[model samples]
Target: MATVKTVTTADAAAKLDELLWVVLWQPLGLPRDIRHTLSLEGEEFELLAQENGQVVGGLVAVWTGGTEIELRHLAVASHAQGHGIGRSLVTEFYRIAKTKNCERIHTIARNTSGEFFRMLGFQTAPGQAPEHPIFREHGISFELMERFVEQGTPADCSTAARSRGG
Candidate 1:
């Protein structure tokens, strides 16, 4: 089993920049400086997943005030896909969000990855705009999705739930 750990921007900047540059920016034709989007000025955080001491996946999330969080970036290494790394990172995010007293977490998932988020209990966010201009400019289409996190409720992290090994 892989392990997930929380990291600060200063601790994982280089690694995250590399991952997001390849997995997100380059593919989206967006500016390469991901720092502006992954800031840690307020209640924001990053989670990294590793297997046998190697980084495999990561995600960044920000608190949108008043019990809501927005997951900004989530990507797994190309070679590490199909393992449970992505799922583990998201599960850890849910665990952390609960600790922050968050009631809901939302994200704008790429069209290609929408089903992945859906399988993890997210549904189309109500009243979301039909299009996001910024991403549209870059030829990317995203869907807004959100998952509610009620107190004492076990988050359905994935369709086929499995124990997160220690």
Candidate 2:
């Protein structure tokens, strides 16, 4: 079974860094400051996942309003891809965000993960918000996606469900 939890404190941030590295970042030539900034305090919310006491995936969310949430990242271990770990993690984030009255969610995603986000009800656009720093990075490219929620269905929720029998 998989479980998710919110991250708090600098120590947990450090742990999340390790998880991001071991599962995604380091293997992809990303930097560690990504983890440091994720925990820089005043973040609206974050969710971390674990299986058998080890981190496997995570999704970080920040609130923009009563009905708007920004998905900073939704990462899964390479080995855990296609296992529903990412979906479950995001589902859990939605449950929490809903409690906080967030009915819309947006994400700026890498080229490869846009389809995954779309499957989860996140849509893609050619341009990004001005303050999103998308153009700051030179080599990397991204697309912006948004999902509007109505009665628990994500605005961009595609037909893709976890491949599990559930």
Candidate 3:
């Protein structure tokens, strides 16, 4: 089973970056320069999923001002996609957001992942998604989605996620 944990050290960050590159950027044919420069501006942190001491998935999020967190990137290694690693990481993301008193979580999801976010209770937000020429050329699109954090303790979020079969 894959276990999720918060990423705190530079080494962990680098590992997560490599995982993201392999699972996301590389597949998209994005260059190293574009991938490395995609970091978001606010306070950022990450959660990583590991199995048998190997990194398999990860999430990057930014505290986007008052009561909102923007999930920047979420990816699972191709070899690990069938497992619940992605769900585990997002559940932990919610737990941490709740602990920080955040009231909502938002993400700019790729068209391919909109359904996945929907399953987690995120709704399409009322705004036009920003377009990138490169992504468009690659037949990829983006959507803005968000979900309000239910009023509860951090543990409550985890319990709720499990009950929902996430």
Candidate 4:
């Protein structure tokens, strides 16, 4: 099983940036600095999934509106997909949100990834997603998705609240 850990130091953040570029951006022909350009303007943090100390997946999220968090990016290496690494990262994200007293989590999910977010309990939020010509040209789209954070104790970090298969 992969272990999910927070990205605290510059090196960890750099690793996550690289992972995001390779898994989520590079294939789309996005610029190398795309991550920096799209980074949220508020309080943000990153989480990484590691197997045998190698990063294989990562997520970037930011606190929004004082009571909400927005998942800005999520990516698992092509070679590591379908192995629950993404799930583990999301589960840990839920735990951190609960500890921070966030009431909900939101994400602008790509059309290709909407089903994955749905499987993790995110519902299509009632709003129009921002338009991006590059994505549209690539046959990709976006949607606003959100999920309420269930009330839980600060110490609760288990997957019970957001595990697959209910």
TM-score against truth, every candidate: 0.82, 0.74, 0.90, 0.90
Residue pairs with colliding backbones in model 2 are 121-156, 121-157, 123-145, 148-155
Please write out the lDDT profile of model 3 over residues 56-103, one tens digit for every residue.
999999998889999999999999996878878888888788888889
**Lowest summed-lDDT stretch of 10 residues in model 1?**
157-166
Model 3 stretches astray by more than 4 angstroms = 153-166
**Candidate 1 regions with alpha-carbon error over 4 angstroms:** 34-42, 129-139, 159-166
Candidate 4, overall lDDT?
0.85
- The number of the candidate with the highest TM-score is 4
Pairs that clash in candidate 4: none
| Tens-digit lDDT string for candidate 4 (1-166) | 7998999899999999999999987987999999888977789989989898898999999987899899999999999999978877888898889888889899999999888777777888988998889889888899999978878543232344346343
Task: Candidate 2: list runs displaced more than 4 Å.
Answer: 8-11, 36-42, 129-140, 152-166
Worst ten-residue run, lDDT, model 2? Answer: 157-166
Question: Which candidate number would show the highest lDDT if scored against the true structure?
Answer: 4
User: Which residue segments of model 4 deviate by more than 4 Å?
Assistant: 153-166
Best of the two (2, 3) by lDDT: 3
